[model samples]
Structures are given as structure tokens and as C-alpha cells.
Target: MNAEIIGVGSELLLGQIANTNAQYLSKQLAEIGINVYYHTVVGDNATRLKETIHTAQKRADLIIFTGGLGPTKDDLTKETISAVLDKPLVTDEEALQSIESYFKKVNRVMTPNNKKQALVMSGSTILHNNYGMAPGMAIKVSGIEYLLFPGPPKELYPMFENYAKDYLLSKLEIKERIESRVLRFFGIGESQLETEIEDLLEKQSNPTIAPLAGDGEVTLRLTAKHADSKQAKKLIDDVETEILQKVGPYFYGYNQTSLPEELMKHLINEEKTIASAESLTGGLFSERLTSISGAGAVLKGSIVCYHNDVKQHTLGVLNETLNNHGAISVQCAKEMAEQIRIKCCSDIGISFTGVAGPKVQEGKEVGTVFVGIAIEGKETVVHHLQLSGSRQAIRQRSVYYGCHYLLKQLKERD
Candidate 1:
């Protein structure tokens, strides 16, 4: 089914808030073989919303709406939809009870306007809102399906996942399974990755190849649809194998597996401990590593040597090295990594010393980076980089490169 996601909020048009609901819904719909043709954003005006709905109904079989479901008077999504569909707004008993129970549980006073959240379109299926007060609804009018959701992402995400997805699935006649696999890659440009798999991307049929580049990384989302689940997976695997054959060296991990997470996975699997000496990144590398669980088994500690004195006094980097090569030099980075590994008694040590943008340091231009890796019983190595961007961008990219370098070293060991 072709669908249109309508976001109802003047805040969205005024740039007060983002319409992330459309992005989430579009991805969800695609997984179910439903194509999202349009994303419409209309302010809280009933007349304009009615016009938008008319326009959507002309082109789409499904119209999903998000926002304007609150206690405020401006929250008129349901009222406008009910008017357009000629359906009366009726209070759902279960929804009303749920709203009341939520207020009671919080020991808060419920205003009269709050009851409006429990109202649903007449003859519509009630979708429970576990995260918020507003109960969403799914109603069919003139053969077009309308799905409503609350404004907050926390409310909309779970409501759609737990209730709306199953409801839509039940309405489908033939249930065709769609499988999607996202291959994450780093140290490769989107154009280069696409060129490697250009043939498959051009003549793609069963499993489609879609390349997206963002923040020094690229991802290829492969989606395959079939009646049988295993057959669909086989189709996806076949395409994946062909793509991997050409540009697999840059491939790091699968869907939703971040660089930090992938690095941690390898460290944990190999039973290796790590420590970090951060300079320009300012402990960001350590923060990324410690953010994921099971990091304790592999992470020993981190030393944020932002100041020259800290590098020399705390991590025991020689004052001679700092004065000679400077703190941003590859030599200093290598020494930092080796010293941290020795001090923390870890199997691996990583270091980040960089000149993030805005000013040149130590006669070095901005975006000059040095990432060093020191592994036990292995030669210490440093990767020199001349990057470009704002200070934050350079720092973030430095952290990503550090993770990628560590992953490469771990993979080499394996």
C-alpha cells in the first residue's frame, strides 16, 4: 500500500520542532512492503488540514498522521480528520480509563481538556498509548485507511510498533515477508563503494542496494521481499556476497553496529583489555568505548591529557618529546599509547592527539590528527590524518578513525 505521512503541528513549519515521525514511519512502512510516497506537514488549521487530507487521499491508500494529540486546544488532529471523514468523535471507554489511571498513578490533577485525548473516531480501532495519555486510532473511510499517532516520539514509536504494525498486518491479504540488512562501512567514500557494486545497484531486482553516506561512514541497506522468509534471506545473502567480494575490505559491521560497538565486540571476544590517552578528542574515545555494555571486561581506563603538563606528568610522556615533536605529533601519539598501555597494564592502548579546527597549533594546520595504537608484542603504529571541518567535526571524526584503526588491528590479529 502506498502511504502518506502527515505531521500536524505549526511548530514543525515554524522550525520549533523536527518532524522525525515521518522518517521513522516511512522506514517502518517500507519494511512491510508499503511505499511512502509523500510526507506532508500542515499547521493546526482545520481548513488547510482538510485540503491536505483531500490531496493525500487522491494519491495514497494510507494516510498516517502524527502530532496535535494533547490537552491543548490547538491539538486538533483527530477533530480535523473526523470532520473530513464525516465520522463523529466518540470517547473510548478503555482509553478514558487508561488516561484516568495514568493521572491517578502520577497523583496529578487531570483537567477537563485532558479527556479529549481519550476520544477516537467512531467505528475505529483503538490503539493504546502506553507511553502517553493520547490514545491513537486506526479508521477506514471510503476504502482509505487513516492511522493516527501521538506527537511525542516516545509515545508514537512504541504505539506504532506494538499496536499499529500488527493492526496493519492483519488487514493485509497476502503477507509477504520483507527482510532488510544494512552493511556498515568506514574508511571508504560512498562513491567508491557504489562504484565497486555499480553493476548490482544498476541491475538490482530482488535485493535493492541503497547507499547512504554520513559523518565519515557509508552504509548500504539491502532489502529483499519474498513469500518465504528463508528464501528472502537467501536472496539478500546472494547480493551481499557479490557486494562484499568487491569492497569488503572497508566493511566493518552489520545493521546498527556502531564503530565503538564493533571495536568493543572484537576486544571482548578476543578477551583483550584496552586503555586510552586522549588529547584533542578530550576523553571522547574513552566515553564512546565505555558507553557500551561489557566494556569493563576490555576497558582498563583512560587518561585525558589535554594539557601538556598532564601529558608529561600524568601519562609520563617525556618533556623532551613534547618540546621536540609537540603534543599533536605522531611521535607523541605513539608514546602516549605505549605509556598508557604500560601504565594501565592493558593488552591494547589507543591515543588521539589532534589539532581540531579554528586555530593552527605547533606550526601545524587545523584538522591535523595523529591516532596511535600500541598492542602487546606488536609494533606501535600511528595513523596521520589531515582532516577538514569544524572543531567538533574533526574531534568526532578523530574518535571514529581511532575506533576503525583499533578494529583493523584486532581483525589483523584474528
Candidate 2:
């Protein structure tokens, strides 16, 4: 079924808040093979919301409304929808009791305005709110479904997941589940990846391929719909295999997973402890690594040897090497990686040295990065990358490349 999402908030239009609920809902809808054709953002104005609903009703069968389900004056979502459908605004006694109980339990004075949250349209299925005051409702008037959910993400996400999702699913005749996978790539340009898979996109139908470019990475989302989930996954895998036949070398991880997460998993599984020596990334590589739970088993530590003096005195890089090639050189990266491994006594050492910039530095242009990896019983290997992005983007991408490189090495050894 085709769906349209309406995000009702003056705060959203004013840029005070983001419409993340639409994003979350769209993903949920897509899993059940529902197409979210349009996302409309309306302010707290009742007339505008009514117009939005009128417009959506002409095109979409499912209209999901988020926000404006609060005690405040601006919360006019349900009122407007009720007026448009000519449904009476009836008070949900259960929701009103819950709100009253909350105030009584907390020993706080209950303002009369709190009753606003308990308003629901008559002849609607009450989607109970477990998170907050506003209990959402799903109304099917004239065979067109309208779901009104709370504004706060904490309240909206859970309410939708618990009640609204099931309500929508029961209405839908979904013969298949839509499974999607994202193949993340760095080092390769989006244009290049697209050019390579141009034919696939041009003739795409089942398991469609979509390419998206961002700061310093490219992601290809592969989606397939099938009655059997395993068959759907196999279709996605087949599409991935076809794409990987040409551009597999640049592929890193899958949906919602990054190079750092994948690298940590590999490192943990291999029983290898690692450390990082940073110049440009400022220990960002280690920072990401340690952010993962149980990383203490695989990550030793890191050193931010940003200054030449720190590189010399702490990590013990030769003064001559620093004076000769500067800190951005591959030799300095190699030394930094080796020194950190020696110091941390880890099985592997990684280093990031680069000119991430808004301007040039040390006779090198911005985005010039050198990733050095020193593994036990192997010569220190350096991978130089001439990246592109702002200083922060370049630094973060350097960390990603570091993980990619480390993962590649581990895979090769295995």
C-alpha cells in the first residue's frame, strides 16, 4: 500500500526540530513492502493540516501523522484530522486515567491542559501510549487509514512500533517481505561506482540498485522483495555478487555497519590486540575502536603524537626522518605505527598521518593521508590516500580507510 507521512510541527518548519519520525517510519514501511511516496511537513496551523490531509487522501491510502499530540496549544493534529473526517473528538478514558495517575503518582499538580492529550476521534482504534501522556489513535474512515502518533521521538517510535505498526500490517495484504542491504565503499568515487554499474541501474526491477554519495563514502542500497525472507536475502546477495564482481575491492561492510565495527569484530575474532598512533586523526581510530563494547579485549590503547616533538620524544620517531620528510610522510606513519605497537605491546599497530585542511600544510595539499599498519612478523606497511573533504571529514575518512586496510590485511592472512 502507498503511504504518505505528515510531520506536524511549527518547530520542524522553523528548523528548531528535525523530522526524523518520517525517516524511521519510512524504513518500517519499506520492510513490509509499502511505498512511502510523499513526506509532508505542516505547521501547527489547523487549516494547513486539513489541506495536507485533503491532498494526501487524493493520492495515498495510508496517511501517517506524527507530532502535535501534546498538551500544548499548538497540538492540533488530531483536532484537524477529526474535523476533516467529520469525526467527533471523544476523550479516551483509559488515556485520561493514565495521565491522571501519572500526575497523582508523582504528586504533581495536574493542569486541565493535560486532558488535551487524551482526545481521540470516535470509532478509531486507540494505539496505547506507553511512553508519555498522548495515546495515539488509528482511524479507518471510508477505508482510508489515518494514524496519529505523538511528536516526541521517545513516545512516537515506541507507540508506532508497538501498536501502529501492527495495525498497519493487519490492514496490508503483504505477500512478501522487503529485505535491504547497504554496501558501503570508500576510496572509490560515487560517479565511478555508478558508471561501473550503469547498466544494472538502467534495467533495474527486482532487487533494485541505488547509489548514494556522501562526504568521503559511497553506499549502494540493494532491496529485494519475496514471500520467503531467505529467498529475498538470496536475491539481494545475488545482486551484490554481480556488483562486487567489478567493484568488490572497495566494499567494506553492510547495512548500519561501518568499517570500524567490522574491523573490531575481525580483530576480536582473531584474538589480536591493536593500538594506534595518530598525527592527523588525533587518535580517532582508537576512539572509534574503543567505543564498541568489549573492545578492551582487542584494543590496547592509542597515542596522539600530533607534534613533531611528541613523535620524536614519545613515539621515538627519528628526528632526521621528521626533519627530512615531515610528519605527513609514509616513513613517519610507519615509525608511528611501529612505535605504538612496541609501546602498547599489542599484536598490531595502526597509524594515521595526514594533511586534513582548509589550506595547504608542509608542502602537501589537504586530504593527503598515510595509513601505516605494523603487524607482528611483518614489515610495516603504509597505504597513502589522497582523500577529499573538509578537515573533519578527511580525518574521519582516514579512520575508515585505516579499518578497511586492517580488515583487508587480516583477510589476506586468513
Give the TM-score of each candidate.
0.91, 0.94
The most accurate candidate by TM-score is 2
Could you tell me how far off, in angstroms, the CA of residue 178 lies in candidate 2 after the best superposition? 1.7
Q: Which 10-residue span in candidate 1 carries the lowest summed lDDT?
A: 26-35
Off by over 4 Å in 2: none
> Candidate 2's residue-wise lDDT over 1-414, tens digit each?
899999999989999988999999999988877899999999999988888999999999999999998988889998889889999998999999999999999999999999989999999999999989999999888878889999888998888888887888788786568999999987789999999989889988999998998657899999998888899999998889989998998888887888889898998888999999999998788789888898989989888998999999999999999999999998999999999999999999999998999888899999999999999999899999998878898999899888888899999999
**Candidate 1: pairs in clash:** none
Q: Distance (Å) between predicted and true CA of 348, model 1?
A: 1.3
Give the Å error, residue 100, model 1: 5.2
Model 1's C-alpha root-mean-square deviation from the true structure amounts to 2.5
Candidate 2 at residue 133, lDDT?
93
Per-residue lDDT over 1-414 for candidate 1, one digit per residue giving the tens place of the 0 to 100 score? 789999999999999998999999988887777878999999999889999999999999999999988889899999999988999999988988998998899999989998998899999999899888889999888899999999999999999999999999888877777789999999999998888888888999888888999889999999999878899999999999999999988999999899999988888888899999999999998888888999889899999999999999999999999988899898999999999999999999999998996988999999999999999999999999999988999999999999998898789878
